[model samples]
Target chain A: MKEIVKDIRRWQKQDKKIALARVIDLDGSGPRLPGAAMAVTEEGEVAGSVSGGCVEGAVVLEALEVIKNNERHIVSFGYSDEEAFSVGLTCGGTVHLFIEPLDW
Target chain B: MNRKPQKDISIFDRVEELLNEEESFALVTVVKGPPVGEKMIVFPDEKSGVGFEGSLGNSDLDRVVSRDARGELTAGRSGVRNYGESGEAREETVQVFVESFIQPPQLLIVGAVDFTAALVKIGKVLGYRITVCDAREIFATTQRFPLADEVIVEWPNKLIEKIGQTFGPRDAVCILTHDAKFDVPAIVSALATDVGYIGVMGSRKTHEDRINRLYEVGVDDEGMTRLRSPIGLDIGSRTPEETAISIVAEMIALRTGRSSIALSETKGPIHD
Candidate 1:
C-alpha cells in the first residue's frame, strides 16, 4: 500500500478513477505478503504489485471489470479454484484480494 | 501542491502525507465481517489521527482492529487476524489486515575498519540504515564508505549520546574497533540502549582483555551476557567480506530467535 500511495494520489489529482487491489491473505508458499498492493487507474496506469509478476495481469483485468460495473468486493486467484479463473499463481498458493475504488 | 488542499483533511490526505514523509503508519480494514470496508489509518502522531475515512458497521469491530493495528505498527508487520462478531478474540468472523508501513531498521558500526566497510555494503542490501562512526576522521569519511547512510568522525560514546534514544529493538550496534579505547565505550553505550544486537569484533585474546577492562569499568554480569564478543557466527570467515556476512547472519539469527545452524536440520516452522 505504501508503494502505491503515490500513484493513487497522482491518478486522483488527474481525476482518473483509481481501483486499489490489495493481497489481503495467502496460503502456503505465496510470493507476496497480505499487504502487497496494486493500483490501476481508469487510464490503465498501474503501480505496485501483488505477486511475483504472476497473476497481476489477471488482477488488472478484474480491477478494470470492477470499475466498469462500479462494484466492490473480494477476488480470489489460485490453482485450487475450480472456476478456471483467467489468472492463477504458479507458486501453488492462494491469494485473496480486496479491490475497491479510491473514492474514500 | 494545488492550493495545499484544505483543512478537515481526509484519511487519504493523511495517508499521502505520511507516505511521502516516510513516516511509519498502519492501516486497518475489516475485510470480511460485519461492516466491510471500514478503514482506520493510524499514524505515529500522538495528538490526532491523520483521518478515518470509513467506519465498520459495528463499533466493536472497529475498536478491535484499531488496537491490533497499533500493535502491528510497533512490530512493523502485516497480517490477517480474526475476531468474533462481538470483537471476541479467536473468532473468524471479522478478518482484519493489520498492515504496517515502517521505516527500515538501523545499523551503527563503530570502527570504520575494512570489516565495517564491507558490513555497510551488506547491510545496505538488507535495507538497513547503516551509519559508520570512528574517532579517526580519515577513516570515517563518506568517501571511504559511500554505501553508508552516515559517517561520523567522533568518539563512540558521544555519537551514541546524540542518537541513543533512537535505538530500538530492531536496531543494532557493532563495535569493530578491537582496541579497548573505542570498544569499551561503544559496548557500554550500546548496552545502555534497547538495540537488539551488540556485536564486538576481536580475536579470542582481544576479547579476553576487553572483558577484563569492561569488568573494571563496572559492567556487571548481566550486562556482559548480552555482548556477542568475537562477533559473528562460527563461520570461519577469513576475509573482511566473508566476516561481514557472518556478522549479518548472526544479527538475522538473533532477530528471528533462530539457532545459527543449518536450517535443513531444524524441525519446527521455518519462519515462526
Candidate 2:
C-alpha cells in the first residue's frame, strides 16, 4: 500500500476511480506476506503487487470488478492438497485477498 | 452496537488516514459471524475506547478481539484469529485478520566501514531505516554511503542515548566497529535498550578479547548473551557484500524463528 501511495494520490487528483487489493492471509509458501497490496485505477493502470506474478492477474481482474460494481469481497486462490488442478501458488501456497474500492 | 461513526470519517476514510500516517493500527472485520463485513479499526491509545470504529455483534466477543487486535498491532504482526459469536473461548464462528500497519524497522550500523556500506544498501532493500554512525567525520558522510537514511559522525553511545528509547523488538543494532574503543561502548549502550538484534562484528580472537572488555565494563552473563559477536551466519562469506547478506539472513532467521537450513532440506510443511 505504501508503494502505491504516490500513484493513488496522482489518480485521485485526476478524479479517477481506484480499487485496492490486499493479501490478507496466506497458507503454505506464499511469495508475498499478508500485508502485500496493489492498486488498480479505472483506466486499468496498476501499482504495487499482491503476489510474485502468479495471482496478480487474478487480483487485477477482481480489482476491476470491484471498481465497476462498487462491491468489496474477500477472494481466496490456491490449490487444495487433494485438488491438483487449482490455481495454486507456483511455490505451492494459498493466498486470501480482500478487494475493495478506494472510496475513502 | 448503535454507536455513530466519527464525524466525516467513514471506516474506509479512517483506514486511509491510519495507513498514510504510518500509525500502528489494526483492522478487524467480522468475516464469518452474524454481521459479516462489519468491521472496526483499532489503534493503541491509553484512553480506552477512543479510536475504535464499528463493533462485533456481541459485546463480549468485541472486547476480547479488540484487546487481542491491539496486541497484534503493537507487535506489528498479522494473522487470522478465531472467536466465538460473543467473543467466548469455546466457539469459532468468526475469523478476524488482525492486520497491523507499523512503521518500518530500523537498522543502526555503527562504524561506516565497507561492510557498513553493504549492510546499509541491503538493509534498505529489506525496508529498514538505516542509520550509519561513526565518530570519524570523514567516514560517516552521506557521500560515502548514499543509501543510508542517516549518517552521523558521533560516538556510538551518545547516538544511542538520543534514540535508544525508540528501539523496539523489530529494530537492529549492528556494531561494525571491530575496535574495542568503539565496540565496547556501543554494545554496552545497545544492551541497555530493547533492540531485538545486537550484532557485533569481529574475528574469533577479537570476539574473545572483546568479551573480556565487555565483562570489565560490568556487562554480566545475561547482558553479554544478548550480543551476537562474530556477527552473521556461518556462510563462509569472504566479501563485504556476501557478509552483509549473511547478517541480514541471520536477522530474518532470528525474527522468524526459522531453522536457517536450506528450505529444500527441511522435511515438514514449508511454512509453520
lDDT of 2 by residue, B31-123 (tens): 555655667777776365465667766778778888888888877788778878778776787777677878889999999899999999899
DockQ, each predicted model? 0.36, 0.39
True contacts kept of 1: 0.39
Clashing pairs in 1: none
TM, every model: 0.77, 0.83
Using lDDT as the measure, which candidate wins?
A: 2
For each prediction in turn, the share of the native Cα contacts (below 8 Å between chains A and B) that it retains comes to 0.39, 0.36
Best by TM-score: 2
Candidate 1 residues lying further than 4 Å off, grouped into runs, are A3-18, A27-31, A40-61, A77-94, A102-104, B1-13, B33-38, B44-65, B81-95, B234-241, B264-268
What is candidate 1's lDDT per residue for B46-129, written digit by digit as tens?
346443334556666656666667677877888878899877898798787777888888999999889998999999989889
| Per-residue lDDT of model 2, residues A8-73, tens digit only | 879988999999887888877888887788999988899999888888887888899999999777
Clashes of each: 0, 2
